[model samples]
Target chain A: MTDVASKEQKLSAEENISSKILTIYLIWSVIISVSIIIVGTILFIVTGKSGYNMENLNSLITAKGSLSTYPFYIQSIWSGVLTLKPFAIIQLGVLILLLTPFGRMLLQVFIFLYEKDTTFAIIALVVFAILLFSLYMVNILEALHIA
Target chain B: MIYIVIGYLMEILVASIAAGIIGALGGLGGGVLIVPFLTLYFHVPISLAIGASIVSVIATSSGSAAAYVRDKISNIRIGTFLVLFTTTGAILGAFIEHITPVKVLFFIFGIVLIISVIPMLKKIGEEVPNVERNDPLAEKLGLYGEYYDSVLKREVKYKVTGVKPGAAMMFMAGTISGLLGIGSGAFKVLAMDLAMRLPIKVSTTTSNFMIGVTAAASAGIYFFTGDVNPFIAAPVAIGVLLGAIIGTKILVRIRSSSVRKIFAVIILIVGLEMILRGAGVI
Candidate 1:
């Protein structure tokens, strides 16, 4: 509601024309991610199970830790999706949600370049670089055992 | 067996919905409500709870940011410019989160949540934002914009000052986002409203625009660290997103004055509980 208070305000042609691509993209990304999550949840319900084992969850509460010990990567989720594993489907949705903003930064780079706004393009690129670095930096460190 | 599963998932879903409603009504955020709920009632691990909370934060933000950005009330130049510091701090904060003890993280989250309640209590002063001489950096960068305010029924144009200080505060905001797995919009709005002195509407909208990007910086880190458990995150994200959508639909119909006060009190209580949880006093 903090930001939504401004929702009913009308946008001028200038504002509307410039931001159309991004506005549509953001809405779709949220829609797609949320829908996927819903599908995953339904799959979980029908099967009376999740991609994760009930035993794992039970153990998690008792162990005072987490159920996910496997190395974090996309391949596992892909394979799980191939089998229609419910929780894996959920993870795929989560992955999309995670990517939405990163993708926004990527989209902004193109938007800026298209507009020939060199300053903003560079700024977007810098933010993109930082976001990319944030996503993969820890992975890089762990791969080298430097972390 | 199916009913049992339904009931279990429903419990999380419903609690998340309640949190979402309160968050939406109060103009607060879900992460502050959720982390404590998951930890205290659901008994989820602190790390997993944070991971889930951050994911839901993105869900709620994306929906609102879409509207703000599309309206162009959010200044792309200023938002992206500040994002540099936020993303940088987010990366640093995520790494720090890995090293800090869970108890310490819990304690910090509690303190942050309590402090966040202050601005909400103050009632966002709709009075015009502070006007200052535009800094050369802001002028060069074009950190200025105008938006039509529906209530004021006029277009308000504004310039900002103190770019360096504002950027410094954004860095801290980003660090808090990465560290706590929350948006830290309070700090962000503080930086812009009190420090940078942008118009209130612009400050709030731009803060919305930046939150998703900032959270993504740390969320990606959480994903890679295996802190993002699908079971917890899936339900929480879905529930909060749905709840927020529902809240917005009813938002215009409801009077939020009394509701905001109640929710603020609830946030204070949750903050205390999180602190006690970290201190092992409860």
Candidate 2:
């Protein structure tokens, strides 16, 4: 009975940790995504243009200068964000939303490690690696002209 | 330019809000609604619409998932494990997206939406399933969870099985999501509920958790490819996020069977419209 009790306690403790981590991640994601979107919307209204013109819609559709040269654009996004460009700020918000799940998985890796659950920790690590690989492999493949 | 910008933003915002509400109710992500709406009604290019839709998927996933996570409705272990297969599939699918023609994408999107409706129609009004047996693989992977169902007013416990099959289905779901820029939650739920024998609530919530990660995997490719237009994506994301929050709140308070049926009908109509449009018959 005592052994069962101890196990239950451990499970609850783990649950608590998981819940806490998720709550923190969710809060940050909401704050970041919502704020940037609002700023972007307001700026979009005020400026009456969104960096990309309607004339470029055709080029955007065909992906003329975008996909092949995406890495440079990604770099520009960083600088744009740092400079508080409205569109970039909006993109940054979407970026944060996209990355939140990746962040959560990374947190799970630590949580599993702390629990001494080696199998699940390794599983989490593998998922993390896949996410990171997918993010960067596009650039490499584009450079190789194999994409 | 000002009139064009306002027109574009307002249209996407309104469309996204509708998609978000419909998506949340359906347990599918907003991408399903946004992609077709953008391409069919607004005449947005398929790739940019898809990019914006993918972003909206992440927004809805994160927004609704927060509430689900807090309620302990989502099975994180199952979601995380499946992410391995889905992410790999997403990468491959993203590559396919680059090479596929717009017409072909429309055809596939329409067909997929139609196909998804079949399962929903069959499972309409079905209650949570009972699975008494557990697979050894599930035990090893620790794929069991319990959540208090607010609607039922009781704690529901479930164990998963068919791990290999579920993972395979998730791979397919991920590929479809990447290719079409939708969440493909219907397939994810089917893999869990039908193949893995998990309860419906668990399946839906866990699928929600998984969608964000799967979309994230492909979102990177979309972002770098300049497919994600901030002007289009920004309002869509915000609108969908708001709609999803409201949907999540509603999800916990009501019986979902009726909601599922209503959502199914909506999906069926949309699916047929997409097919007709793609076939150039409309």
Candidate 3:
């Protein structure tokens, strides 16, 4: 099913670290996505229909505030898991993942450059530039709240 | 319960497809297309709609990014640096929602969206095929690049600079995404074309490409908070996913220059609706 010929044609004779690393990253991403879906499903079943509404969510957030400043052990070992609000945790995760493309893109560039393939590097760069600019726009709009 | 789950699943399927197509071709988040419908027709809460849209954005990004990287359409180095700032901004913006009033936020969101589309409309008529120089600015900053357009069947090369304005514009795009859950597609295009002076095709492709990652980052938070009610978001996501796919296929054949006007008009109407709603005039 995989494009073996195309893959072989792209990869040079050298043992390129960038391509190897990227392959690892892609594998990890798939694993993480699947695991999260599974875990989330289990949590949904365990939680049942109890207190999933907005009111409970607000309470969860408030509880987080109270528990956040506890000592390292309490905050990390107990409160972080037990009172750890989903919104706060999920928001941090999603946003961090959102920035993954930038890193992924950088990895692509390093691979292309290592292969001495200027053409692919150029294309990768163009796409990266657009991402950068789009990011810049997001920053400005948020700061100004001009909507 | 079973019916609700089935219905929700169906909605997400549709939304995912629509977001994927629009994200691939039109270079915008599928969420922008989904949220308004959810809030207006489905009577879903705005917060929940935003959350679902965020998830779809991440999905779209993942789908497209993998393909684009394989096709050599995305640039990693530049994309990486930009994310450093956008992610920070997204984290901060998500928290800001806690402080801002819902109505006021939407009003501002509607206004900014309208303003963002105007410049795109203005540039639609001019199709200049020229690359700026790879001078000290482009070389030192490492912004020179190229892409192959399947439609045009040609390689397009480009040079770009103006990092300051581009970064500044990204800040605005991040804010809009956090506020409206739309991923601010047009604003992203504007920053690349206007500030960095990249080709329109390149700008659209990259913007279309990176939005998913940005959306995913925020989606995680919404999911943990239980803001993502699959029921409401499912229908909206499905409808938009279908709509966007249809829109993208048609967009290629139709004159997008003129469509920009239509899009602008739609946003204007929506803006007025939002204003009326905000003012209790509805």
Candidate 4:
């Protein structure tokens, strides 16, 4: 009975710590995303159009476009970050939002390792790897010249 | 020109806010409403609409997940285990989206929405199931959790079962999410509520948590493809995030049965509309 009690205590303690961290991460991610989006929106309004053409919204739609050209945006993303364009800042916000879960998984990996929970650590690691692969699949494919 | 741009932004913002609220209340996530609205009303291309919707899903999922976690309602373990399958499925689904026709995607979306409502309709007014038997899979994976229900004023403990089947269903859910650029919350809830026999609250919260990772998996592909328009996605993300925050607050106070019925009716309408659009009848 004592063993079960201690186990439950440990689990709750772990949950408490992780939940606190997750809450902070979630709040910060939202703030950062919203801030960037607001700044981007303001800049977009002032500039009348960011790098992309807004006058003719129809041309911007890529529904029937070739899939091979999809990675072209990544180049702009790099330049946008380097130059600090409002559009790129907005894109960066979206990227950050997408990466938030990935960040949580990374934190879980560390937490699990610190707790010496090998099973969960491995699981978290696998999740982290899959997310990394998905995020970088375009670069990988390009490196392999498969696309 | 400035007025025109502002007008467009306001429209996207309002629509996204509505989608976010409805999505959080329904546990379906924001993508379902945002995608249909952008495509049907604004004449936004399917790919861009989908890209924007996926981004909004991340926003809604993360914003609400924080509240759910703090409340101790979301099952982190189950969500983590399922991510392994859902993420893999999402990647495959993203590739498939590249070749799929827009009309076909709409048809599938409509079909999925309609089918998911059936389970919700059947379970209306039903009490949460009590699972007395222990499944070996759940035991091995440590897939059980306890949360205090403020509405009921008691602690609810739930043990998950049918791990294999739930995981399989999650893969399909992830596939749909990735292909359609929506949070496949309906199917995720189904897999947990039915296959795993979890409580509805646990199922919904866990599904919400899992959605961020699932959408993230496909979002990268969409981003690289230049399908994510900054102009549309930015406002949508901000609006949905705000709406999701409000929805989460309401979720904790509302009865689960009412939420289910409302979710069913909303999905039923959206499903019919999508079908009509896809069939070129409207």
Best by lDDT: 4
Candidate 2, residues A1-147, lDDT tens digits: the string is: 999999978987887887777777877777787788788778857875444433444443334224232212657767766766667677777777777878878888998887787888999899888889887967876886745
Report the TM-score of chain B alone for all candidates: 0.88, 0.96, 0.82, 0.98
What class would a CAPRI assessor give candidate 1's docking?
acceptable
Structural similarity to truth (TM-score) of each candidate: 0.88, 0.93, 0.65, 0.94
- Candidate 3 TM-score versus the reference: 0.65
**Interface RMSD (Å), every candidate:** 3.2, 2.9, 8.9, 3.2
Predictions in order: lDDT: 0.77, 0.80, 0.53, 0.82
Scanning candidate 3 chain B in windows of ten residues, the lowest lDDT window is B230-239
Model 4, chain B: what is the TM-score? 0.98
- Candidates' DockQ values? 0.46, 0.51, 0.09, 0.54
Model 2: per-residue Cα lDDT over B1-282, one tens digit each: 456657767777888888898888767888898988888887778888888889889888987887787888888889889988888888888889988877788888888888887877787666777777778889988888788988888988887788999999999999999898998888888788778988778888889988988998898888776778776777888888877877777777778677668677877788888888878886
lDDT of 1 by residue, A66-112 (tens): 24422246887788788898877888888999899988998898887
Model 3 share of native interface contacts: 0.02
Proportion of native contacts present in model 1: 0.67
Model 2 whole-model lDDT (C-alpha atoms): 0.80
The model with the greatest DockQ is 4
Misplaced by over 4 Å in model 1 are A1-14, A60-71, A140-147, B24-29, B119-126, B247-264
| lDDT of each residue in A1-147, candidate 3, tens digit only | 369867655553432456357646644553354343333333433443212242332332122211232111223323323544332233333333444555566666767788776765766665456555554553454476532
Ranking by lDDT: 4, 2, 1, 3
